[model samples]
Target: MRDLTVAVFRPDDERLEDAVELIDSLGATAVPDPMLAVEPTGSPPRTDADCVVLTSKTGAELVADAGWEPGEATVCAIGPRTADALREVGYDVDTVPEEYTSSGLVATLEGAVDGARVEVARSDHGSPVLLDGLEAAGAYVHETVLYRLVRPAGSGDSTERAAAGTLDAACFTSSLTVEHWLEAADERGNRDEALEGLTEATVGVIGEPTRETAADAGIDVDLVASEATFDALACETVEAAAPTYHE
Candidate 1:
């Protein structure tokens, strides 16, 4: 009965540290491998839109730090965290979808955005679902790339562990993290072995898009967390890997 070793791929920020701590508290050994790094693009969302959508907390913080204010525009955040970030920066969050995904925002704003200008501000890797959905719903949409998510250098240790079949489980928070993890594995010539090893491991993902990416990449996902939070993802994965973790 050894502690479950779960690999977590988050950006090298407080989020990564939080993931490690959460896994440790779950009685698991966390292999912290940062697969995503945020590089600010220095572009801010235009304030003239009828409605503004901020996707990630990082996007909200970046735009606010750059002094980009959403004036009179209905402020919409894709998730509660994004909403909190917006509110923390002296902005009003007028809308937050219940689902907290790109499609969720589309559904929440579709009726109101007809013939209105909608500005979507987020990372370059943001799913096209939100933009395409909004466009289909008849909103004149604009996108602002607040930052780019890049794979940090030397981030493939988890891939190596996976290739060796040492990792018991993994928690992936985004589609980009899943893609980056496989990319890192491919770079280390362990893509095939790593992929194979993952078949035996419990793979937990946060969102539908991430699950789709993992499925498309030929990875078997064992669970999709009931919620998109890291705590749910890590706890569910650790429990699946070691059922007695909480007991």
Candidate 2:
């Protein structure tokens, strides 16, 4: 079995180190070229919501940065990573759905949030599933965009590698990563070639929603982790690319 190179397109945050460690554990070279930068939009408005929902680790960090304390309000996170982020900043999370998607969060809050007040903090580009569902379920939802995702400057190396067909697999944690990666390839005048190259390589995504998003953008996802976390995505990538696993 030849050593594989897995290109990781994510933010250069603590999670990036986790992905690198997981790839190294599988004896593969991890090429981490962060594609997106998370920028806090602004300080969130003062709210008296009964519950606070955080959908991403960046959102948790942003809320903490805004100096908002979840006093008596219930803190609900979308997944373990987000929950950990909130916990690390001194908030005890009250709920984390078995599934990590917005739909899953909505399902968990449906019966519990009737006639309640909820504040949701997430990215500006976040989907409306959770917000809309909560509102429909009788929660007065105060949705705030705490952060925004933008393509980082001078981070096109992984896209170039993909264009050159040098990567064995690429792990995309979000749909934006796929979009930004292809946009970078297009900027280099190699969009078509990069798309072809990606078709030959394994595409690992964090969850079904991201896989659907990638597929909508013409990327055929080869692996999808059962859980929506970097570690799970890295493991799925290894399983798809490891020669011993194939044998």
Candidate 3:
């Protein structure tokens, strides 16, 4: 298949099945092998936090799973996708920045931090920018790890998918996914081959920071979404890959 294949760097768990199917329907193969594990700690100590911050769909999904209602707190999401996820479960998203990242969220947090209590729901590998920024602004910042970024023992189903040669491209949504994919492939003794395939294949990232990480590792990004959202990413991917087959 000359059509682009999108290796979804999400975990092979059942949670992402819908997304995989959706991508596959676009005439692209979807390979799932998560570089991160989302761990829910249930509801943490909810303080008098004036606002709630979400960094990813994982964080928003964790909030949805906790079944807790926000009480007089503003909800700030890093991007439109995270905000949509939060809103899907009846959480009102109060802020979404044009640029998507914890650092971007930190910039927006400065003005809002005055006399406010803020809590961040994010992964164990979350950046310190948001937490540090809020603390510096004199807002009490609370945070809990809702996930862990870890590599698997092997390539998982991705290796089989790769060998099929239907794969044309792969999308790395986060830095952890890129790192963990390499780490996991290394454990399987196919690290070099995998790296070669990834490098030769069309590589797409979700945003600038992730692109920086991939580029630093010598992977050139073929495409990046204009907006940092799943819908945007998927659309951009399909657009980027569509021209190769349409001719």
Candidate 4:
């Protein structure tokens, strides 16, 4: 079996459960860290926009729960998972880019959103790429803060494991996860130690923006997953740490 210990920072929920299961399936031990916690703003997206965009599965679910009705509006999602979430909530997704990142959504919608009112509904820590790209393309872009992601209490166990050099790999799904991981380390008075140990481990991020954030924070990222999916990130990080899975 693959013996690598991979650290993953997802909210302690079904997402973390899925990640741990996926790592186990690949034969790699999972070091699950609950990092992001969703605090909904109770603010729904505007329904009168020409197009409505959802960036995460949580955002899609939140908006759907708010009963956001998209009347004569194009529903855009950044990835298949989010699109699937929207569809599951009885919303018709009109556009999903070939690439799952914000940059990809920008590229896919830039040509068509030149004169449209684009509504981007996501978490507080969302990247500026989508909003900026849409605005640059001449769309009147409005951002709706569906939720704010905060670090959960008692969630830095993986940082201690990282500092101890026990982690063979890490899957960072968002920029906030990377930043909050280091913050947790700092609070434990092992920031430098954790960072040093992290350098020895294979690091995988969800997309280019996360890679940039990690690199800027002095964490050498090993690879950016081909897809912006947790399964892709976990598997890629596992492969980077242990090229061949045993047993």
Candidate 5:
């Protein structure tokens, strides 16, 4: 099979190194073009809650930066990555759902949060599924917007390359990545072309929510990770593109 060019849109950090390793493992060229830039909005509130829910690594980083004490609170993360982030900051994660979506977390935390105080820390653009579900389950939910998602300045290049079908596949970890990429494509005056190009190259999403988000935005997703993790997404992308390269 021919070597493939896989565009990675993760942040420029250790996570990006992980993505590059995965791409190299698949014998693909890693395109290190970060699409979204995360900035902490402000210090998160220190709450004396019974449990704390972190949905993303960024949220975990924000909470750690705020020097909030977990105290006796049960720390629940959405997935292994978030759990690892929390653990890196001296908080032991109590629960990580089998599935890694907000709906999945709500399902896993159903009876556990009843009549408990739960704090949710995530991005400003996060969905309210977990918060609403916890509130419905009788938890006093305190929500905090830890970070905001912004498009980096040079992200337009990758969007244009994707639109022009110059890349073999594009891996998207979050719904906001897809949104921002398309928005940048539109701003570059090739929204339609970019959407068409997405159909030509493989589109690998991290999970179901991101797949749905891409579909809603009129992009057909070619691959979805069984687990909502970057490694799984990278594997799925390579598997989805293998047949094309061999043919």
Candidate 6:
């Protein structure tokens, strides 16, 4: 069998081992080239708000890291996994979108936002779409940067092969993963050739935004999980790409 290389651009250390296990089960080499590295913010905010919006599991973990818990106010999550994470830490999630995205979550809000205060717990580098949309809905948005996502230092030789068109697929969990991969490709001077032939290979994305980012980068997404969790994404990638490998 030809050796298949699949890069998992996972930013979180907590999720890397599981991603590796799943990728290895597919008989493909998994590369740990993290495009985004997360580091926690100093502390959770002290101000009280009417609601808290969590955009990622990373955000929920940060809240736990800060030793804070949601009290009285409603907690809204962008997806089920995020809500589950919050629930693990004792938060009562009031809203979670069927589609795992900020736009979808914002659309599912309970009441008029006028006079309500909402705090968004997320990475400093994350998109401001949710906060802006919430404010536009008349909720006072308190933006808290609970973590920062930075690109990891080295991506190694397999990434070079991936850029050179030898790899079969790549996995993306966040829109930033696609952005950072493209940036890394640019830095390595492989941008043009990489995108042109990217569609020939499979791309696995976690959510709508990541899928859209893959499409914007001219890569065809061949797999997206029914659920937005890391495990679900990895399983979907293997299940979707297994037939091709066997054939």
Which candidate gets the maximum TM-score versus the true structure? 4
Instruction: Residues 120-217, candidate 5: write the lDDT tens digits.
Output: 88888787788899899999999888888898886767777777778788899888898888888888998998888878888899877788999999
Candidate 5 TM-score, true structure as reference: 0.94
- Candidate 1 per-residue lDDT over residues 109-163, each given as its tens digit: 8988889999999999989999999999999999999999999999899999889
What 10-residue stretch in candidate 3 is worst by lDDT? Answer: 156-165
Q: Return the TM-score for each candidate structure.
A: 0.95, 0.93, 0.82, 0.96, 0.94, 0.84
In model 2, the worst 10-residue window by lDDT is: 238-247
- Give the least accurate 10-residue stretch of model 6, judged by summed lDDT: 154-163
Off by over 4 Å in 1: 244-247
Q: Which stretches of candidate 3 lie above 4 Å from their native place?
A: 1-3, 12-15, 43-45, 64-69, 136-138, 152-156, 159-166, 244-247
lDDT of 6 at 175: 86
Off by over 4 Å in 2: 244-247
Report lDDT (CA) for all predictions: 0.89, 0.84, 0.72, 0.90, 0.85, 0.76
**Model 4 RMSD in angstroms:** 1.9
Error of 4 at 139 (Å): 0.6
Best lDDT among the predictions, by candidate number: 4
lDDT of 5 at 242: 72
Ranking by lDDT: 4, 1, 5, 2, 6, 3
Model 6: residues with Cα > 4 Å off, grouped in runs: 26-28, 110-112, 156-158, 223-226
lDDT of 6 by residue, 123-184 (tens): 88666678777888889888888888888776433347665777777788888888888888
lDDT of 2 by residue, 16-49 (tens): 7877888999888898988889888796834687
Candidate 6 global lDDT: 0.76
lDDT of 6 at 222: 87
Model 3 earns a TM-score of 0.82
Instruction: Give the clash total for candidate 5.
Output: 0
Across 128-176, the per-residue lDDT of candidate 4 in tens digits comes to: 8889999999999999999999999887888898889877889999899
